[model samples]
Target: MVRRFGNGTATARAREEALGKLPSPRGRLPVIGHLHLLGSFPHVSLRDLAAQHGRDGLMLLRLGAVPTLVVSSPAAAQAVLRTHDHVFASRPHSPVTDILFYGSTDVAFCPYGHHWRQVKKIATTHLLTARKVRSYRHAREHEVRLVVAKLRRDAVGGDAVNMSDLLNAFANDVICHAVSGKSFRKQGHNKLFRELVEANSSLIGGFNLEDHFPALVKLDIIKRMVCAKARRVHKMWDDLLDSLIDHHASKPASERGGEDCDFIDVLLSVQQEYNLTKDHIKAQLTIMFEAGTDTSFIVLEYAMVRLMQSPHLMAKLQAEVRNTVPKEKDTVTEDDLTGLAYLKAVIKETLRLHMPAPLLVPHLSMAGCDVNGYTIPSETRVIVNSWALARDPSGWESAEEFVPERFLEGGSAAAVDYRGNDFLYLPFGAGRRICPGINFAIVTVEIMLANLMYHFDWKLPPRSGAGRWH
Candidate 1:
């Protein structure tokens, strides 16, 4: 007994020594530690704090009971996301995820292990493959056409179109079609999905009280409060998902899971083979809906905002899109997107400046690992401040400016890409947990942006132009 106790004591001491080696700011309170230091915008605050106190772009903060590691530089990002990826591939299961994601079985929030690997495989192999996305080209093009038509119709009245709603609807419908082979808006599910996504975002997208004070949440009152809200949301999701899955499953085998099938059909077809539960299917579909619907719209909205602010860049992109597609064509097709370098560059630049998930879904270290010559103990919550890495002046020229040309030929970041290859600009993250829907999301944005440029000359309204795009 004495020997075992002595060994455990040595291990605990070593763990503390390892964590103590990393740079951390002072002012750790008795219970909350550094929670008070992080303000309204934790990402921005963390970025500034890291600049001041981080060593080799690594900063440690004791966020309540959790020990958090903030990664801010390219080298440090590579170390944590690539060299030690397997060790940090899992997620920290928060109360929100457990309640909403049906015990956290979805790809985005699922803990890494046999289940995650299998779920991700189903997503990549069956749902989000390049071929699968390509197969939906007609559906995507049709969605874009609807948007262009809506804008043109509104222009005749000289009334301003709500680009946010249009872009959001376009994104929502595209994902809905891909997931359930239905039009989300026409079927009256568009607003429902948006509401649920917003509700889920409020819970899952950031650090919550339960995340900081994990033990405190275990108390009956707090647990009931958190679980009640999430469960209410989950019940709505469950009802909708059941209807969609049932609609698809009732179809004949050949018609449902053959050459063309929605995500539900595919999931149902593979259910028996994969030994998946009904809850598992719903969880995967939910993340796909939430992540898919949100990413494309934000990129589209911000791209327009940035373009409206900079006329030159907008003109440059418009020229490329207009000149590349034949004059005979009324709308830009996916094929016309070929060799549209500036168009892709503009989208790439937008993602860099405004990734939907700035501090990407937190990665949990599964085992003790050495990063930047310091040991990160097992189960440490790791956050890669990707926003800082992408915007750091050290690695980017004119970093603060919205210059898409940097991604074109002969520019500084010309070699950089978002596909986990270059760590400097990780818009979609990297390594094992890199987003699998990149192709689906990018192509959807491209078709829409390309057509918007090809068909129209944008101008801010007389009243809304000044100081608005910024």
Candidate 2:
């Protein structure tokens, strides 16, 4: 029998043979190739370089010891994230994430393999399923009610609410209850959760000298700082997760029964089925709380900022939300969200403009592949510049503007969806590695937003003079 490519392997090989070397910036340095060119904002910097070096919107750069491919256009993104998705599904390894996220044992950063697949299977099927998320509706509604009460108090006091802080707290409360079965803030202790989030943010906010400069990898000062911080964060995070797990583990399996068990309880129940240990349970919980809470607040903050900037748009969404839910109803339920098309559009527009993770977490190629006629070597770090792709002029009209109307009926952007099918608008990303928590995230956001809009009228600080949202 003649051997043949089963699923596009032959086609990819042919394309790679036809196309030669990948496009890269010239004058790369000896050790820190192309690292000097990237400023603080790497997404914007890469976008600029792509304009000059990306022949087909794919540009290769050497960041110290790592060879990275930046995909700055929608077509290029499709080739990497969809056309050859399986080949590039694994995540890149970083010392920072390894320490902070338990050696990338968590679902978000774990490499693509048996372990990752198993964890993902358990999480998607049992932990984060739509039914599982729906079971937590009471927790969500209760948290949102608390948020509204706080905001109403501020409103009565005639004070300008710090919307970002308020939303962050709201997200934190919801995630805490859903994950560990209680709110740390409400307990007035164990604020370690919030501290961990801040530490992780600081460590991963941007590229550090150690990341790009292999020569500095052994520097004692850098190692000490990184290790010390990691140890501190790990200790606190571990203790908290351990206590939660132990608290649940102490209970008899029968007593911990039912669909309403918190995430910790559920993970413990299936520990033997999935062959999961306490460490594995902790890693997953850490990610769930960190990723869930942070992204929710970021998206909410941006949406509110955009709405405040455009009063007319705010009023329009608010009216839709208000009309959908009766005046007598205390809060909007998940059922009411289905009919609020405009509100959905507003959230979609917000994600397009301000994606929480602009690069959609860096992906590593498991094998060599061809993308848009460019040969990408195995283990190459791939970054899909979702920020640039979302604002590409070719795919979107007035892409820079905040226009929710584009997603309305009969508009050019109306047919496009953000569930990753349309590469031109992947806020959550595409392929097998797409964010599995999308449904959970969407429901959490929609319900909270529906209540926020239905209840109060928001305005900018008096005489602030339309300052920058950031």
Best by TM-score: 1
Point out where model 2 deviates above 4 Å: 1-20, 183-186, 214-222, 463-470
Determine which window of 10 residues in candidate 1 has minimal summed lDDT.
1-10
Q: All candidates' lDDT scores?
A: 0.87, 0.82
Over 4 Å off, model 1? 1-10, 183-186, 462-470
lDDT of 1 at 366: 78
What's model 1's overall lDDT? 0.87
For 302-341, candidate 1 gives per-residue lDDT tens digits of: 9998898788889999999888899999789999887999
| Candidate 2 lDDT, 116-216, residue by residue in tens | 99889878998899899999898889888988888888888787889877888778777888787753555553356766776777767755566665456
TM-score of model 2 vs. true structure: 0.92
